[model samples]
Target: MVHPLAPLSEASAIPRVRRLSDRHIAVGERWIFSAGFNVRSDLADTGRVDVELADIARLADAGARVAVVSHQGSYRDGTARHLDFVACHLTALLGRAVRYVPGTVSDAAVRAARALRPGEVALFGNVRLHAGEEANDPRFAARLAMLGDRVAVGGFSKAHRRNASNVGVLRLLPGFAAASLLAEAERLRPWSGRDSGRYSVAVLGGTKPEKTEIGLVHLASTYDLVIPGGAVLNALLAARGHRIGASVLGGGGRRCVATAAEVMARTDRCEIHVPRRVVVAPAGAPYSPRRVVDLDDGVPPGHAVVDFLLSPWARDRLRRLAADGGRALVAGPPGMPTPAGTDSWRALGRYFSAPRVRTLLLGGDTVAELPYEGPASTGGGAALYQLAHGTVPVLDELARSAAHMSDMPA
Candidate 1:
């Protein structure tokens, strides 16, 4: 009888894999997976772990020898968080204690690969631990190539970064393909189905304005309506010459705001709408003395706009925008003050859950806020930026690999 996993051998059957590499090892035989699990402005990587869990199961089920490489926490952090922490997160989800090996290219690492028990995974040290991973060093890529016969680039959130693990190793692989999770994320659409032919709305809400610029422009250009929230909202309000008072403005939002203005001016179809009311506190006192006020009433100079888009009028507006929807890409939610902000999340849940809604692309922070769970990504700004632009180099190559394999004959 033919081997149950023999179909994976078809990569050689596909001409591209042969052209890319002379190696004969199947995809499941030995593989290096460069995953992206970094967070956006909110410092949440939970979604990243959740997404990768699916890939782990698939690779394990295929009886593949997998070496999972990922970056954790932020670059700005004094030190990279321990890889064991991520192991903990994955362990909870997989319901099994995963095997972890310390070195990326040590002899011991090779031994661990040799010892794989068919469905077990061996997660390598954080890719960031290796000094050359992010530099796209050819030497580092070569070292990683020593482990895997083929490469799979599935970190859609991390695809934008030209790190060695993402593209460099991909270049070395005789052939490569997309991880099932990353392939799913790459399909993110700005507007879905017949709704694209009609009016569509987008929500760009995240803590950092600088990071959200690309998404803002793309949303403004694609959707009929663009709604700003959190720091993005403050910047947009200021762009229109509204009295911002002392609201928290994300550093470097003006560049994005100016870009949005230019796009709005030229694209008469896209509209920018502001909330009639906002929740505010004394400028320096963001936590206390909070109250709601109509924008028409005017805010005091010492007051800050902590949250908005949860008032009755705001909800009604959201209801209409969300009604008969086309597609919604919510990066995150509007700023909320505890008990006050909680209602906004629930309201957002109701709005996005509308039957007319065609698509919803949610990022990490936005995913956490939703009452109803959906596929979310950890690539944060990088993920949004990738979606706005066309195919990423890493994922693009992976697609080519899959296509090539599909074209091969038995």
Candidate 2:
């Protein structure tokens, strides 16, 4: 099924083409680099080329003039010190000089770009600081376009959006997907086939619903959905007429629920599951045993449900369903303070991490909360399991896989 977020019209499917000669290069040459820079435990093998300081070093060593931009300043001091560490390591790896432009992107950033000769590198401050970046404003797109001669998109994590940097800038330049982008595409190729099944399950819940909504809509037709956690589940429950106390509308919360419902309506087979019981607490109190309430029992005013409470029967049913080797997608944690005692969180951790279960954990929080103590794989423990001896599609590469899948003779 076509992802809801996919462009309605298919653009020319451009196989990633490598520029072989400077003739292919244009004057005012620049390479616009961005990375899905979030604190992810399983990012190394997920096909996203996380822009690190070492990447800066590598670009510098190649003598490839580069300019970097991102939505947010990832590091505390704004120096991106960890990235700098990687850059320092890359310098040692390549025996080359690397330079980073300090401060966020602004008119100064534009001026700095103009000052650089071909082969020099500079990193701009977070792109997210500008509201237009997320809004996909044309003016912002035009401004970013000036930084590059040929834009090379390296950030696959943000590939689902038609935002200014990811898609808008591509329209104006001779652009191509970067090595990381291509690699991500190739990594998730297994899900394109018809045999992948229509009854797919997506485990959805996250601190940021807006980001998750993009991925969910894309995969909706391919999966039957499951939502967990205080925010996502609450929104879903609220949609079904359950009062979830506070609203989940801000910070991409409401958008997620609305998008999920749209996908479910479009694909008739979809179903959303919210917890039958929730652990609630008074507005300002810590989660305590006395505060938990059954949804059927009704919640008191000024109370919030903080976790899911599964009965033995429900746990058994979920376990049985998961154990059948059915396709499942897990995103977001089932509960907050996941390390804190929460039965639903523990149950989900056990169910998804079970060897017999065919589970794909999406989003950052889900992976971090997994109980596994050891380094399992580069794509995180859950991804490695889904990709282990079988194939699981990672979202960063969805576009490429969709292209390949659409090409099969039906």
Candidate 3:
């Protein structure tokens, strides 16, 4: 077996990364990564999966003796498949078999990682398996931090939650917390930078309105165009006094609806576009007859409108906007598109890939629905970013982690 400390002479697999002339792990050097892959079945195609794979590959290429710390799933989703899924990817990305240590980043886990041969990696079990993780207990962070000589955060999806793996361990690292090879964090870096001359657009959707920030009132005031879609559209429609029939409302519902109406009515800076047409299913049936209805037609009491009414008129206006240049933010989906997968996502994919759209972002459930190869964040990060006018605490922590690197006594 190759000695763990022997220098790796191989070049980096990632583009433009400088080669490690001598990628040697001295007595106790290891790259501890806070990875964000969850056990949810969606890991099969989500953006977090895509980005983390690249990060792991890069770290492996850098010849770092790596320890991947990941969430198996949300705290309650204690499914073995989740750990099995993440471990599979870790092994593939590292190009060598990985050892699974079923414990917190406790002393045993640390010892197991340290014992690996050069190029070997250890994937720790769900950090959330331990009680101290979610509570941000210092003892947990300290224990987890002991596993590595350095730390990097690879789980962009989990950044919003200040957990033991992502936030706690960083406090003890000597310098900046290393970033997983992140690309979009920079694109979204200037979230708070404001310019009245700049044009912006935001599209808010999804079934759970509770997940949205009423601060969207601010986005409505700031952007040039605001389109409400999915179930949120039902709220906006109701706020505008349109009949939504039996469509379930989400987020702020009546209150949020009223506020949005007032903004659309009063604000000159932003124009709110509610779909005049929508996709509705009769009686909310899985195979119910679905059709596009005019905004005034309303849903029948037993029926539900599940998708944005993408009429010829609606499609034309949206494509025009995409063809034009500006910043665009997609909040999320209201509920699943009714009648299965026909309505919502195809049009969204077109706009997401449109070249002239300039800045494109998707957050919340919307991120999962459309898996385009681009920078995106989960609903939590997206909501906070919108509320803060683009500032994300996780991203901010990543930014601040650098100061610790440069200013602290090395």
Candidate 4:
């Protein structure tokens, strides 16, 4: 009989191996564990064991050769810090030797791994280079498995994904959850209680409409939904039959609008809010105040809607809704980048800066552009967060949200 938690397809394909050592081994009992930086803002203050230098030391001292895999660029100062900490601590702890794989796992990474002795460890560079990693290819899983005897998945933030590292490899080999990964899973488990004083609100914004649609559908059922940023707002407008520019549409904008419409039709309990007023730039021109359109009027073609107009009515509504204590999630930038003197960008910043809103921000452009002078947080379905967290489950959550909303009574 197959293991209960294992997927039916995987279980049928391969019988579950009883012991860790019984599975397979290319070298002296290797244990491959995946890790990533804790990017969540709230976790920073909670005195968590974030797989720091000491953590690696402890593992090395226990005779486990450590292999660190991260997608972050070496040029980035942050990546340097993580590498420095790992290298310094591992060297100090091992006191003999260490090896580093400088680039992403490919033929090169495989070659490097093959060269390692039974007891030696090899750290592969970023795993994101292979498109199969995101697609959760079995071949990729098999390749990754070649590096270790047993797999210990510790990237909790990424556990929700069925990707190669998070799921595929687990199926192919004996799998164990890393301590930190288990802890994060446990932390989120209590969130099932509706009255846990932990209601979450997500602000969905991104350039990709499909991703935004999926993320919003998921988050909307479990938490309050706040929609911002030009792309998402435009999609909302398009769903309502407003005329967005053909240029934008051909460039992956139409698909977003279509996804939005589909989502709006599917979900009932999740409230989808669009901006009351939108700043639009005429085709091939930077946004100007003269082109701003109220949602009461239809959007014109050959124009891009840039920012949410925080009118008194909208501001009052947001402030009132946010007065109650709960978490707020913000994704994507509030507006498109405009000319330096344009009011679109400035207005977008002001909307985010408004009082009475406690926000947990996610996505790269959203965090970079918006002047959100509050406690910042990061968690989302973007490729950046996927690489950072080492998994992508935002899409799954989005699908679940849509289903939950569909089940709600009208």
Candidate 5:
């Protein structure tokens, strides 16, 4: 039951979860879509939520009653956030009324879903507000299952989590992989460990050094080379006793540096290319005449490493890989925007977007900065977690459920 596009090394181990399009989508059938609508404090970036639109629209167009359920904010912070704005945003994008169901798994929410007609869509309230969702309570799962006849998992970002909406609901109903989730699995083909025996490169960056360090270990196994940049590079430099000055460490502190050192010590599977020359500027201020100095030249007392310029040696390696038709993956921004308004994100963006290099970009900032018509994912954490570990928890549950219901049509 492996996906047609999934790698054998990984996919063969999991039971098949049928795609939503393959199911008999009958009119008036209730379709519960589990999606990730979590937003930042600023609420400006809705890409994670927006990516679910196509599949949601697909279900509605097929005359199915649709209910989108997701958490809205960081549940760890204990701050309750509503999905009122998400419903309104969807109404605008869909050009149709999307009823906002103000409770999750509550009697009122169940009533709202039960009242929906064919082709109608509703956005359920934040699932995290319910104590049972995060706990994956069976009773809560039964309550949510009452809203729909089938389940569609469209949130790849939450696939790794074991939550009521993610793993619990599948036990009670037919489950299928939504379009976006399938797209994510397909785009991650590079990390499938298929053993092409060819050159592949992974460029690691992003603000979270701890997460990036974990991905670096996994990326090294799948890719022939692992290149570090951004805060990840800063941590690596610090691990090797190089002075990084005032550059951001993503708040991981000494633990981050220790993790990087550990990775450097144990990583023997792939080549790690650390930038020797870097662009530097005064910390917290834009200064004229930016300096490109060697790594040996420690960052000055009041300065920080702004970006790393690829040496001819590293550039040539990438060029050779491209010539050999190998793939390249960029996880996060290689550099941050300078105080003076210049950005290095575009520099790496241009290189990867070239037609010759088969590229895939992960992370929201990566996709936002470089909008290319190729493999990309906005869920950096989930994307990396899957790449590192071959299976996602929710997807695995859905696969098992699909296998159990094999006697019935999808």
Candidate 6:
């Protein structure tokens, strides 16, 4: 795979994004605003919905007809595929009625969008219900494009996707990115840059071992120290010739361990700390009472690693690192979101919360698992993708569309 980090000269070549703030919204103009509302399965917790809400209010309050477009993952095998829940939340948050359109890219949706007067807002149904939405079919893009005079994308979680609603629609209509989305990109960009003098540490872990490995390898180049936890901790242990027993090695299993070994070999610029004491349970039983075990003693057969507990000596090291006044970045949860696993996340959170260690948190699980909120990214996977790969699909589309608009005759 090509290295995700580009030379500074090459990075400078990427076009400047056209933001919604740069556009002049004429009253009554139709705006198809794509937003991300699928944070949790039940949609009970609105992660970063307020950001999109603020942008929508800007357009609606300016007398523009706003039509919201969004997609939700299939719940329990194709159940609960409507946007009414989001509409309800938006209505309450916006302090106004948010009309719910029954379908997307259908005649009824078009009619509802057309019927909306200036300053009114309506949310269309989940676009994923239609096959073309994910396929990025031009026909679907054209239909969605017709729903509005311009497109405003606010779905940072979906920025990595090349769907009709984001990438395809940009090709068919004038496109502008939401301020919140741009802000997310700017915040995550620093991790991929050249290392500075200030000490920086990255705590890398998550349910996805493969992604964690990728992040770990990249971060080691720029950070002063790198710590592995969660499934990543398991893989690194196996790489170091330790018996992890039946611990979760992720879906990749042996392959993940191999990659972890390779990453450890290549990353010589920074120090990597792999916790010796970990919380463990019976292989197939996560609900069982967990016990802390030292890796020096082999993990008993039929058991798996679940979480980590920093030894007192290691804790003192972190405290000293904090006192030096540096920065820290946490990408994923150090443990599973189980009663036993929460301990590790809490411990790491407390350490990073120190005033001297300015912390930057990324990934949804980190936010959901941690007790306190700091600066965080709502889209975990997307944020990781941008961090590793430099740019996302939505940002590229926004820049491309803006460039095309500039070249066109007035």
Badly placed stretches (over 4 Å) of model 4 are: 1-29, 36-57, 72-98, 102-111, 114-121, 154-161, 179-201, 246-255, 282-291, 296-301, 337-358, 373-378, 382-410
- 1-410, model 5: which lDDT tens digit per residue? 33322232455343456777666667888889999887764658887877889889888988999988997654665875888888988999987799988877888989999999999999998888877888899999999998898888988877767889989999988788887887776667565563576678788877865355567768776778777877788888999999888877886767778878887887366777787888888877645457887889888887778778776677787777766667787787776655443344544555566667778788777766554567777667777777776767876887787667542422
Ranking by lDDT: 6, 5, 1, 3, 2, 4
Model 6 lDDT tens row, 16-101:
66778767667888899988776554665687677798889999999999999988873324643777878888899999899999
Sort by TM-score, best first: what order? Answer: 6, 5, 1, 3, 2, 4
lDDT of 2 by residue, 185-234 (tens): 34443332223443344555555654335444544444444545656666
Give the C-alpha lDDT of model 3. Answer: 0.59
19: Cα error in model 5, Å:
2.6
Give the worst 10-residue stretch by lDDT in candidate 3: 1-10
TM-score for each candidate, following the candidate numbering = 0.74, 0.68, 0.72, 0.63, 0.82, 0.86
Q: Could you tell me the lDDT of residue 235 within candidate 6?
A: 85
- Candidate number with the higher TM-score (2 or 4): 2
Which regions of candidate 5 deviate over 4 angstroms? Answer: 1-14, 38-51, 61-63, 77-80, 92-95, 128-143, 194-197, 209-213, 251-253, 280-294, 300-304, 339-350, 371-374, 405-410
- Position 125, candidate 5: lDDT: 84
Candidate 6's C-alpha runs over 4 A off are 1-14, 41-44, 74-80, 189-192, 251-255, 267-269, 296-298, 311-317, 338-341, 406-410
Q: What is the lDDT of residue 143 in candidate 1?
A: 81
Judge candidate 3 at residue 147 and give its lDDT.
73
Candidate 5, residue 114: the lDDT equals 92
lDDT, candidates in the order shown: 0.61, 0.51, 0.59, 0.49, 0.76, 0.77
lDDT (10s digit) by residue, model 1, range 1-410: 11111122221121121221222333447766677656433435465656567656666667777777777554444455547666666667777667777786677876776677666676777677766777778988888777766665566666666777877776666344444333444445433222455556567666765344676766666666666777777777766667878887665657756755565567443666577777788877666868888787766788988777554555665677566454555676656445445444555667777776654555556666555555455555655665566445665555454444332211
As for TM-score, the candidate ahead, 2 or 3, is: 3
Roughly what TM-score does model 5 have, to 2 decimal places?
A: 0.82
